[model samples]
Target: MRIESPPPSGIPGIGLRPIERSDRQAWFDYLRLPEVHEHTSWNVHQPEDLDPLFEIHESVSPTSPRRLAIVDLESGRLAGTIGFHTVSDLNRAAEIAYDLAPPYWGRRLATQLCRRVTDWSFETYGFVRVQATVLVGNERSARVLQNSGFAHEGLLRAFRMVRGRPGDFNVYSRLATDPAL
Candidate 1:
């Protein structure tokens, strides 16, 4: 499938670009952060564990989850990543996930990134709904979704396994008809 590059989001001082091969080390380093895995399902026990993900990132398709590297425009630093996954053309829906380095946390960057990607997905994919699942204790991410106009759907019991333990997650969603934040 031919995947068209999304136009640069007009947000100032931040940009989203494709994750490149050269980013493998940086991406690995970010994922290695203990805080990054605290609320996420990612289980990166070792460096080699990320090989499969890197492979997937290398050959992304429209039907597959589109991963975009979030960069600091002025410094050109890899600040984080955001992506839409579980896309269903028939259902016109998808799920979103994101992570930022600890240095970028508490800055409302996640909210801006979520808003940009949500708009892009709805506009480019004609998705009627975009969903995001946040670990139950992750108030920050939940707030980011809500701030981005996503409504709380419900709790998903044992939704994911984080660090080998079953975890509950809160499901939030935004519809194309929802007012933009």
Candidate 2:
């Protein structure tokens, strides 16, 4: 594949740039929504607790391609964030986690954001697979993956220990070979 450059509009809906560090509070506000956070990689939110984790995004090595913040074009708000932290070069794969602010839910923002980043990853970095795990009850998160072309691969009983309890999980994956991709 030639991996053409991303659109001049810079990947459309998630196009708003530079992911202002000042938006950290807004990002924290998103986490406070139970609808948004129940399925999140981080399950709880408090004003003081978010800064350190938000810092992790900010601290990504400048040369490292593992992190990003995506903004909403219409509102210039931090729609959400997406990143790859557990990466395997040999397998050409990475695990991604992202979410749109609670108010942005159901607007197809998450799907657009996922596609924008995945396209960038595949075209820019040659990833063969992108994967995510959603808690079984989180219909919203599951829909985001499905709408973005990921398929449910498997289910694991008590697959993840989240918020201190064993919970069922659905593993969703989208391969570079996927027709929709």
**Structural similarity to truth (TM-score) of each candidate:** 0.90, 0.79
The per-model lDDT (C-alpha) reads: 0.82, 0.70
lDDT of 1 by residue, 48-129 (tens): 7766765665554655667788888899888888887787878989899998888889889889889988898888889999
lDDT per residue (tens digit) for residues 80-168 in model 2? 77666567777888877776777667777677777777776777778899998888888888888898889899997898788788888
Candidate 2 accuracy as lDDT: 0.70
Candidate 2 — which residues are off by over 4 angstroms?
1-20, 58-65
The best candidate by TM-score is: 1
Model 1 reaches what TM-score against the true structure? 0.90
